[model samples]
Target: MAKIIPFKAVRPTRDKVTLVASRSYQSYTQAELEARMDYNPFSFLHIVNPGYKYHKDIKGKDRYTLVKNRYLEFKEDGIFIQDEKPSYYIYKIVNRDGLTFSGIIAAAGTEDYQTDVIKKHEDTIEYRENIFKDYLKTVGFNAEPVLLTYPDNKIVANIISEIQKERSEYEFTTTYRDTHYLWKLDDKDSIRTISLEFEKMKTIYIADGHHRSASSVLLAEQLKSENKKHTGNEPYNYFMSFLIPESELKIHEFNRLVKDLNGLSKETFLIKLDAIFRIENRGNQLYEPSKKHHFSMYLDGDFYSLFLRKNNDAFKTALDALDTQILYKKVLEPILGISDLRNDTRIAYSHGKNDMATIKSKVDSGEFAVGFGLVAITVKELKAIADEGLTMPPKSTYIEPKLRSGVTIYEF
Candidate 1:
């Protein structure tokens, strides 16, 4: 069974939360990052980007040490405080688009990840994992929780609904216009009830933060080997996670862009694609795939819809049925000769949130030879892939709600 336990999170004071909670550092452009750090002293970016204060770019263990120092400074300055009691945090986000996501923030067992109780649908890079593991080991805290989704349960839902009735501990709006509300659930009975409900669940799926989860597990193993008095209940044994219902997950597709046609003429490429797809040209009109196994492509100033030829016996596993997989097998690999999706410079991905206009613009500007739009993968498909112990293609999903860092901190 899955294991989830409450922790006493270190959080920014209610008054400073709006300024302190920030989107992941990479999300910001260099100019935007500079502006925020210049104007907002309380922003968490200062802690992560410690070099900003020194006007130097710090790297490796030096950066890690400086990050730790900045975090301590925040606490000393009274911008952050720790809860005396262990409790589950009920966190809710209502984005500017008016979509809502609610979940519980707690510690999830690394053992659960090891034993497959906490499932994954994406593969993590080893070097990236090790880099983050080293950073976590030095910093000794995780400010960002991995996004996890579980099968919906009435018992857990009812508990969250009841707790939300009262005024939240932290209610603030970000510059993105997203409102965040957090309630502390420390009462013993309610904590027990939430714990019991989660314990009944067999598995949970990772929606985002695969590297964070993998690095946390790696750190736990390292810490266990080093400690002579190792105990299973140590903070290192679990990583922080935000657990929501599967239904609450918002998934978007990643449209593909290719720089060149892999030495093939546009007509020849269409001919090769025609072997697996029944093609139709929708000239000068924007189009997006409407269903599974269907795809929309923009090439040489026209849009085309490609339908998978019926009775193709390719789908043997959950991974095979994915639209991204189908596109790779039918077009990207065989027709275009672009096989390494991760490392290939010939290809790029844009999230569906950008819409077809971005795809058309990029292709029309001579940056890319063609662009392909796919229907978003469904929750059922995602769960099936995880359940089958399979990983999806890279960039297959663009998931939300994109969480904010420094909202809650889990320390070892």
Candidate 2:
């Protein structure tokens, strides 16, 4: 059986939650990063991206040491405190767009992950896995959670709803118009009950963070090798994870951008694509795919909807039926000659959260030649593929709520 546990997490104090919890460092641009460092003294970005603070001279140095030291400082400064007992945290976030989600933060076991009780759909890069493994080794703790989902479980739902009513330990709204609410499940009896409820669950899906979860498994293995008395029950055997119901999760598209037309003119490219697609020009307006076999294309400052009229037999496969899969098959492979999405130098992808205006702007400004906007893949597609023990096409899904760091820490 998959075993999940409640742990005494190191979390921000009530007053410092907003200040201490920040989005991932990569989310910020250089200018924005510098501005944050200058303005927000308590932002966790300083700990993760310390290079900006050391006059940018911290390059090639061990950043993990700085990260770990800063974490210790925060705890010593009373900015963060450990729970008195093992607890599950009720975390709720309402985005600026009014999309809301609430879930629990608990320790997810490596045994579960290895067993595919925690199913993964994305393929992790070996380089990224190692980089993150080293980062975890250096930082000595998990600051962000690997997002996971379970099929709707009534028992888990009842416990979360009942606990949320007892008043929250934290309730605050950010400047971005997103509200974050957290409740500490501090009682021993309650913790035991939550643990028991989750153990009954048959499977969990890795909704996001393949690299982080994979790295955690590797780190746990490394720790066991170095220590003689290592037990599976050690904190290292579990990683920080936020478990939400599958129904609560959202998936968005990862749009494609082509740097060049591969030496083909706009007219020539259209002629080539005409062999496979029935192209309808939407002109100067944003066009989204209305159905499965549809595509939204932006070329020379105009939008066009291309319909895949001829469905192939290969479309029945896990990777083939996908919109991104279709694009790879009929367009990227046959037309543009961009064979590999991961290693190819000709293409790039942007998340669905980036609006059509940005995609069009890049094409119109000569930064990119053309763009493709995709209708999002649903959680259904993800689960179906994972169930079949198959992986989705690269950059196929963009799952959000990317959780804030420094809010809750699970140390090994």
Candidate 3:
């Protein structure tokens, strides 16, 4: 069973939360980071980008120590406070597109990840896992919560609906046009109810933040081994997570762009593709794939529809049947001579939110030779892949309710 618990979170002061909460550091462009650090004194960027004050880039263990110092400064300045009691945070996000997501922010047991109660569909780099684990050891807190999803439960949904009726403790809108609402579930009854509901669940899938989840487990292992009087109840044994129902997850596809069409000319490429797909000329009109095994391609100033030929490719596992893998196997490798999706300089990817015109423009600018659009994978497919111990290709899904850091922090 899944184990999730409330924690005494360190959070921004109620009044300053809107200013102090920030999107993940890497999400910001260099100019955006500089502007926020320069103009907004309360922005969380100031804490994470401590080097900005010294006008030097700090890295490794030094950067970690500086981050801890900067975090302390925030607490000392009365910008942040620790909750008096452990609480489960009910977080709701409504994006500019009118899509809404509601979740419970709690500490998920790292042992659950080890036992397959909390599952992952993506592989994590060991180097990244180690780097983040060491950083967590030095910094002593996690601000951004890993996203986890479970099968929708009516009882949990009803509980959330009732709690949301009350005025939220923190209600603010960010510059990104997303409104965030947070409510504390500190009362024993509410906390116990939510915990019990999760305990009844057999598994929860990692919707995003595979590395964060893995790193948290690594930190837990290291801390447990180092402490002579080890206790399973220690804070390091749990990682911060935002638990949402599968129905609330918003998934978008990552469209592909390639620099060249291998060595094949346009005519020869189409002929080679005909072996696996029923090709249709879509002319200059922007096309989008509407279903699985269907694809939209743009090349030489025109769009085309490529439908997978019935019973063409064999599927031995969930990973084998994924659209991304199929594209890599049939088209990217056999025709385009592109094998490594992650390291290939010949390729680029755009989120589905960006339309085909964006893909076309890149090709038109002579930066890429062709582009492909695909339908986003469904939550069901993601769960299936993870259940089978399978991982998706890089950038398989762009999940949202992209959280803000320093909103509710887990400190070890």
Name the top lDDT candidate: 1
lDDT of 2 by residue, 1-412 (tens): 5577888999888988888888888878889888888998788988887766578646333777787887788888988899888888889888998887888998899888898889999899998898889889888899999999887878778878888787788887776778888988777776777677777878889999899999999999999999899878888899999989888898888899999988889999999878878898988877877677788899997899888767443466676787888888888888888998999988989888896777898888898999998889988889888888888879998896768888899998
lDDT per residue for candidate 3 within 246-313, as digits (tens), equals 99999999999999988889999999989999999989888999999999999999999999998786
| Model 2 Cα shift for residue 119 (angstroms) | 1.0
Q: Whole-model Cα lDDT per candidate? A: 0.94, 0.85, 0.93
Instruction: Report clash pairs, candidate 2.
Output: none
**Candidate 3 lDDT for residue 246:** 95
Between candidates 1 and 3, the lDDT winner? 1
- Supply candidate 3's per-residue lDDT for 162: 89
- lDDT for model 3, on a 0 to 1 scale? 0.93
**Candidate 2, residue 173: lDDT:** 78
* Candidate 1 error regions (>4 Å): none
Q: What is the Cα-based TM-score of model 3? A: 0.99
lDDT of 1 by residue, 331-380 (tens): 88987888999999999999999998899999999999999999999999
Error of 1 at 152 (Å): 0.5
RMSD to true structure for each model, in Å: 0.8, 1.8, 0.9
Sort the predicted structures by lDDT, highest score first.
1, 3, 2
